[model samples]
Target: MGSVEIIFHGAAGTVTGSCFEVRANNKTVLIDCGMFQGTRSLEALNHEQLPFDPKAISAVILTHAHLDHSGRLPYLTAQGCHAQIWMTAPTADIIEPLLLDSAKLQAADAARRNRRPDRMALPPFIPLYTGDDVTSCIGQIKETCYGAWNELGNDDGFRLWDAQHIVGSASVELKLADQRILFSGDIGGGSAIQCADVPLGGYDQIICETTYGDRTREPVLISDRREQLAQYIEEALGKNGNVLIPAFAVERTQIVLEDLVALFESKRLKPFNVFVDSPLAERVTRTTQRHRLTGYDLFSVPNIRFTHDVEESKQINSMSGVIIIAGSGMCQGGRIRHHLLHNLPNARARVLLVGYQVAGTLGAVLRDGARNVRISGHDVPVRADVKIIDSYSVHADRPALMQWIKDRGPVSGSVFLVHGEQHALSVFAQDIRKAGLAPHVVVPMLGESWSVSANHAAKRICPAREDLQVRIAPRDWTASLAALKSGLADRLRALPSDAARERVLASMTRALEDAESIRTIT
Candidate 1:
């Protein structure tokens, strides 16, 4: 019997980048080719050499259109990977605008950085992938449907099941020889809309995402979430301030629109200027409307303004008592930054966070209650009311994740966790073990590989790379601590007193000595 080997390339430890490779006989397949995001250290991995030759990949199965899952397609194409990309029809439609917008953002960021005259001379800035690369990647896409088996060459095949994370998200079932492996791309158990059904009791091995594995979310009723949103809008509008929502262009935007519409239709919210600011989000919203016509709507709201031109987007800043929904969900970039710049200092303004914010992202900084945050080289005061509603997230929580696994019956082979932080993975792994849901549970590190046979036996043939050990290491608390210390030192140095300088030095020495003591004990 032939053997099937699966490799964890990214998203094995951290939550952002996601890539997995499966090989059987002489053919190879890739599950996802997402880009690294969040911290600069992690984002640098996007420019690092890919672990395997992309050209050798025979095909790729995309689970959804999220950047964290499909952002690197253009980069892969640029690197000479000519694999046939497969996804649902909606994913195909949504990814087109998302990728092109990503390219534009990258180019814009590079241009902005190079314009600083005080900057030291460096190599010319280049985007990760150009517009042509995105076109090339789109040309290779082949659409598929839910519940249909498609061949992956060499007698291995896969079936896509709706993952319910987004409009076209899916979970994959790969059949190799006598063994069946299921990949849970991203599970959306607590979403506002109805998620696709979860398949049960058919696979030998399962790879799952644990984005919310460690935390149990409060069961948020959709009506309650909508009511809360209405209250926030009313409060902001009463002060003649605008309400800004930095949302994902995909499902998040659609769902929020639906909620807003429901509130308006129910007469719970007053009629106001609702602007869909991101051009990409506008296109996505249109696509979602078409899908909704086919009985796949979250909630449809009418009388919203869709702004695409730069002048129109700029005009939004001058408007009052408006509700604006824009992209760059984490506030790392995009039009959301411009809105934040204009509204953050306005005490009457409200910023509603409706998605998961990665650590080190501007969204996280705001969510963590930073009194002052740097934006476009300016320190913006956090005067606006910031509100976060947990129900808006698309990922499954810990209880839902565990129940999903349990409902899938017993896995004869093993369970592997990905797409989560170290703490979430650790907690979920323990939960799985304590529940005895699988014979073996592995929290894979990046570059790790496992070989599985038809008889349900699996062996680890390769360990993770030592150089990329940080990819699997526990969340870098040291980095955060160092940043805090550095910021404090800078503030102390600006105190214009020798006593302040001495205090900085004294604090630094104490921290270093404590670190040394911990290191010695470890």
Candidate 2:
């Protein structure tokens, strides 16, 4: 039996990026090459040089089409990776649009930044990768079936199992000589109406995700969730205002549409004009409809209108008492931000969040009831009601995750937990030890590595990257800066006299000067 080594390249202490490198029998393969998301400091890592050489990788196994798991594929191809990328057919279909949209967004953002007057003298910003890179990467992808084992050269192979997280999501089982290891791509909770339950199996070693390992959610039935949505929409419309839903263009948007259709068909919801304002969401919805998995077209409903152009999307802001669904579930970018800028200060409007928001994102800020937010460099007051439906989260909760782990049980070697915050993974590790679910459990840090053998415990080799330790914090300086700006503004406005406001501003200016002096002296 050949020895196997695994490296934790991403998604170790933080929840967003999801890359891993596996080496066996003089061959190397990458499990995923996801992008780092959330805070600006974290996203900045996306432009840094990859720790490993892309040309050395033999093949890449993609688990799904989500940006966090597949965003860096184009970047890899741009860096000279020529290996065949393997994924399920559905993933292949969805990623083409997702990656292309991502490229466009990046290009647009770079152009916007470069256009700033302050940035005119600085080096022009460039996108991480272009549309051409995405096309090149897509050309290398080969579709594979769920149950069949495909050879990876040198007598090694892998098989795919349904992860049920999203359309075409899969958990991979890798076979190398006498050893087998499994990678649990994001597992789906039982809330998805179109996906089946996750399948289970045993392996010598397992690498699992702990996205929601610290908490167990209350069970929410489909009917109950739909009723909750109906209530929120009705209440918002009753106040003579529109409802804005910022959703992910992939599974979350489709799920919301399906529930909306169900509510209308059951006469639980009144027919209101609903605008699907995101072009990417529209494309994804069309693709889903083509699959015919839901037995009916979700976009065929008479009340739902898809806006195909920028002018049509802009028209949505002028309408009242209607429902608008947009992309970028986290409120990071896209048409949702424009809608938020327009409606956040409207006392009668409502913002409904339907997915997990990373800790440093604008969505998290609004979900936590921030009264003022900065969107597109403009400060906006939060007069609209912001609500969240936790039941809509696609990730499995603690109980479901534990149950899935137990089902994949009798693991003879070790279980490595990744893709979660530090606290979540730590608590999960403690629980795993209490239940004796595996012989060994590891909560790996970013840049750490382990060697696996059939009869021995997994051995740690690579040390964690000290530089990355700061990047794992839930909130970074960007969030802090925003809060500071908002707080300063509010305090200045609340002062009883103009002199008081001037005094506060003068004090802040003096502090900044003193800090600058200290830096110069040091």
Candidate 3:
């Protein structure tokens, strides 16, 4: 038997692209073949060469249907990965339309860019994959119910638990070479469905997400979320303006729809026109309705319409007193951008952002209070009332994450933290150490590999490049530096002789000046 090894291919130092490879017993298994998202630099990584051969992989286990976690499967399929893609039934049903829509977007973008008159004289843009590739990838998917164990290869087995981050999301538990390793796939909070009391302990080693490792959210209840949403809808309607919500197709759209349904069903709000603008979100919403658990029919809301044609979508822009939920949650593409272009400059309109917007996305720009934004080759002024309710976030906050890890009863091995920014990863690693929860906690970088033995001892085989190491202090660097300066000043004042104090202060000033004058390259 060979040593069980894990290689981090993505989501090591950022919040997206979550692929990992586990090798043992002469067989290899992949977990979550997600795509790199957000910044242009990160998106470029999507076109880079994959680290491992696709054909060599035995199987793939998917955690959910979100594009960042499942977007690259078609590319992998195009590259000849014939391994059975495993996921829950809901995920399997939803991923098809999502991936196909992704391909359509890619092809459309390339075409649009090629048509530009000022385009650089470069090679014609080619999409990463086509609609056919999405078909091929969907054909390989095999569904399994949650909590059922499935054998992957000799002496290797895995199971999935409800992660509650979204519908059908899961946390994987794998047994390989006599050791158990748990992979936390974007855990949600206590209020999420089927995850209120998720099992967090009892694994030899844990590979966990730290997406919210450095922050906490306000204590906002579901009632608060619904109340606020109702107020926004009423206020917009009163002004004879529409409400635009740029939502993720899979989970966020469903959640918002459910809340809206509940509000009208309870007679708290009058029935009004609600349009689902994106075809992808509409399809996913229908699939979600079919996959609804017993007695949980959320699609029967009043005054709701699903617009699938371009003309139908265009009609919504001129309508007032309507609620439009559309996708490309980050406002980077899709029908949401069109809706934003129309409504953002209308002073009476309202735009509510519900999901996390990464740094460079249009959603982030709007959230940061940019008065003018470029959309579809035009600059549009932001005259609408934009509100962000972060309480709707699905990812668990820092305290929740710590509690989740601590609930894992007495892990004997180290914790490998992934899926967070450098700041969050560094802060969370130190927090784990200070709490004495683990003997060692590592925030791995891209392409780093580690070996785990049958006894659960782990050793890193490849270190991150020296330049990529996040060397910031655990406490805020500015605060820590200021505290050090204050302590040094006090100690200098305590010196027995004025001459000695003056000498030390002068030396410190010179050192500070020298530090300031030094130039460093990133």
Candidate 4:
């Protein structure tokens, strides 16, 4: 057998964007081609040239339909990649609406930016991929079942196993020549109300996600989670306020709806109208219902209303004492931001955060207790009660990840960790060493490559990009600048007199001038 090489293209040092390249037997396949999220600098990476040639890839094995894991497929296809995209049936269905919605959002954002009076001499903005590109990408997708191995000729193929993270999420086991490598595609905590437990198997080498590797969540049962949701809603309603939930359109929305249905059926929650205020979420809910993936009817309840148009969404602003579930889970975009802009200043309103908020996103700012935030060019004060329900997260925690890794063990080669922040990756690397789960544990950097052989440990073949570590830092410079601007404004407003504020501004200007002069001298 010849040598096998794997490249960490994305999600190596960052929490989102999960693309990997695997090559062997004169064939090159991409595991995923996702988009970077969070900071603007990170999202800008989506517009950069793909590190590898898309035309050179023979096939693409998708792990799931979450945008971070599948968003860039259209961009790949736009760049002339005609490779067959393989995924579970549900992912194939879900990605249609997801990709289309993403294209629409990008186009709208670009148009909005271009229309701005302050755009000045900046070049006209363009979306990364258009709806026609999404159509082409969708045409290339081929559906596969969960348990059967799909042959790729020359004794190379792959099998999909349920990841239990979402409706059709999966972990992939790839066979190339004589080597077997398993890719843990975002493992679930195994307690999700909508999905089943994760399956275990042995592999020669493993590449796992470490999204929650540094922290262990408190164990929560399905009933307990629902109860907590009920209490939060009730508390908010008691104050005669609406409960706003910023949820992802996929598993998070479905799971929240499942719990809500249970609570309503059991009469734990009083009769209150629950609005699902995202068009994409409504589409995903219908897809899940068609698949019969969840035990509960996600959208058929009497009190549940799925708003489909801007008019319907705007109507929610006048309502009170209800629960609103909106998408763009990080509160970065989508209807959630609109909801927050209207409700955040209301002292009676409650903003319920039920998913992981990457650093520098609006959700993280709220989660970190920012008293005021800039939204849609308006500075909005955050007086609404912000509460987080960690149990609602679908990603596996440290304990679950360790158990999953151990269950897939007896591996004779290295176990590579990806899809985590720098600190989580560092902590998980040490944890794997202490547990003795594998002979070697590797934490790959973005764009790094490794050579693997059946008889030897995986060895690094190339160094990662020099600026990758800095680029993937928890908070980017853009977020810092925004914070600095907000803080400076607040400080200026609090000055005793206009003269004092003027003096502060002058001093700041002199300081910047001096700094620029020093840089010029250097």
User: What does the lDDT come to for candidate 2?
Assistant: 0.88
Each prediction's TM-score versus the true structure: 0.89, 0.95, 0.84, 0.95
- Cα lDDT of model 2 by residue, 1-522, tens digit: 867999999999989889999998777889989988888788878989999999999989999999989999999988989999999998888999999999998998898879887678999988999999999999999999787779987779888887878888898888876678999999996532222353455678999999999999999998999999999999999998989999999989988988998888889888888898878888888887665478448667999888888899998888999999997999988889999999999999999999988878899899999999887667789999998888888899898988888888888889999999888999999999999999999988889999988756899998998988787677888778878876677778889999999998899899999999999999
lDDT of each: 0.84, 0.88, 0.82, 0.89
Deviation of model 1 at 315, angstroms: 2.2
lDDT (tens digit, per residue) of candidate 1 on 176-282: 76578889999986332222574456568899999999999888898999998998899999999999999999989888888887787788987686998888988
Best by lDDT: 4
Q: How well does model 3 score by local distance difference test?
A: 0.82
Question: Which candidate would rank higher by lDDT, 1 or 2?
Answer: 2
Worst 10 residues of 4 by lDDT: 191-200
Per-residue lDDT over 404-437 for candidate 4, one digit per residue giving the tens place of the 0 to 100 score: 8898888878899999988899999999999999
Off by over 4 Å in 2: 117-122, 190-200
How many clashes in each structure? 0, 0, 1, 0
Sort by lDDT, best first: what order?
4, 2, 1, 3
- Candidate 3 regions with alpha-carbon error over 4 angstroms: 191-200, 294-302, 454-457, 465-522
| Per-model C-alpha RMSD | 4.4, 2.6, 10.3, 2.6
Worst 10 residues of 1 by lDDT: 293-302
Residue 393 displacement (Å), model 2: 2.0
Better of 3 and 4 by lDDT: 4
Candidate 1: what lDDT? 0.84
